[model samples]
Target: MIAILKTGGKQYIVKAGDVLKVEKIEGEPGALVKLDTVLMVSDGSNVQVGAPTVQGAFVEAEIIEQTRGEKVIAFKRRPRHDFKKKIGHRQHLTKIKIKDIKVS
Candidate 1:
C-alpha cells in the first residue's frame, strides 16, 4: 500500500518500510509519530484520492533520529561597491521509517 501525507508544511508520497528525511518533527528517537494529514491512498490497481484529505486516514512512522542537512551558502555582491555578504545555514531534519498506512 502507498499513501500521500502532509507534515511540517510539506507533502510526501510514501509506503510502508520506506525511510525518509523530513522537516524537523517533535519526537525522540524510537518514538512513534502519527501523520494524519492523508491526501491519498493506493493499493496496486485500486486508488483513493481525497478532496484535500482522507477522512479517518493516517500514516504511522518510527522516528529514527534528528539530524541536520548539508550546509547552504548564500552570497551576494555589488558590482563596484565592494559590498559582499555570505551566509550559511543547515536545515534541521528528522529521519523516520514508515510503519503503516491506515484508511478507514
Candidate 2:
C-alpha cells in the first residue's frame, strides 16, 4: 500500500517501512506519531483521494531521531556600499519510520 500524508506544513509520499526526514517534530526517539492528515491512499488498483484530507485514515510512524540538515549559507553584498552580510542556517529535522497505514 502507498499513502500521501501531510505534516509540518509539507506533504510526503510514503509506504510501510519507509524512513524519511521531515521538519522537526516534538517527541523522543521511539515515540509513535499518528499522522491523520492523509491526502490519499492507494493499494494497486483502488485509490482513495480526499478533498483535503481523508477521514478516518491515518499513518503511523516511529520517531527514530532528531537531527539537523546540512548548513546553508546566505550571503548578501552591496557594490561600493561597504555592506556585507553572511548567515548560515541548518533546519531542524526528524527521522521517522513509517509503521502502518490504516483507513477506517
Candidate 3:
C-alpha cells in the first residue's frame, strides 16, 4: 500500500520500507514518528482520498537520521558599479523510513 502524508508543510507519497528525506522534524535516530495527516491511501486497485485529510488514517515511520541538504548559492553582480553579493543556504532535513500505513 501507498500513502500521501503531510510533514514540514509539504506532502509526500510513500510506501512501507521507503526512505525519504524531509524538512527537519523533532526526533532522534530510531525514534518512531506517527504521521496522522494522511491525505490519501491506495492499495493497488482501490484508492481512498480524503477531504483535506483522512480520518483514522496514519503512517508510521522510524527516524533514520537528521541531516542537512547541499548548499545553494545565490550571487548577484553589477559590472559597471562593481557591486557583488553572494549567499549560501542549506536546509535542515530528516531522513525517515516508512514502516506502515494504517487506515481504519
The C-alpha TM-scores of every prediction are 0.95, 0.97, 0.92
What tens digits encode model 2's per-residue C-alpha lDDT throughout 1-104?
A: 99999999999999999999999989999999998999999999999999998899999999999999999999999999999999999999999999999999
Best by TM-score: 2
**Better-scoring candidate (lDDT), 1 or 3:** 3
Q: Which has the higher TM-score value, candidate number 1 or candidate number 2?
A: 2
Candidate 1, residue 9: how far the Cα is off, in Å: 2.8
lDDT of 1 at 104: 79
Candidates' lDDT values, in order? 0.95, 0.97, 0.96
Clash count for candidate 3 is 0
Give the range of the ten consecutive residues with the poorest summed lDDT in model 3: 19-28
Best by lDDT: 2
How many steric overlaps are in each model, in order?
0, 0, 0
Give the deviation of candidate 3 from the true structure as CA RMSD. Answer: 1.2
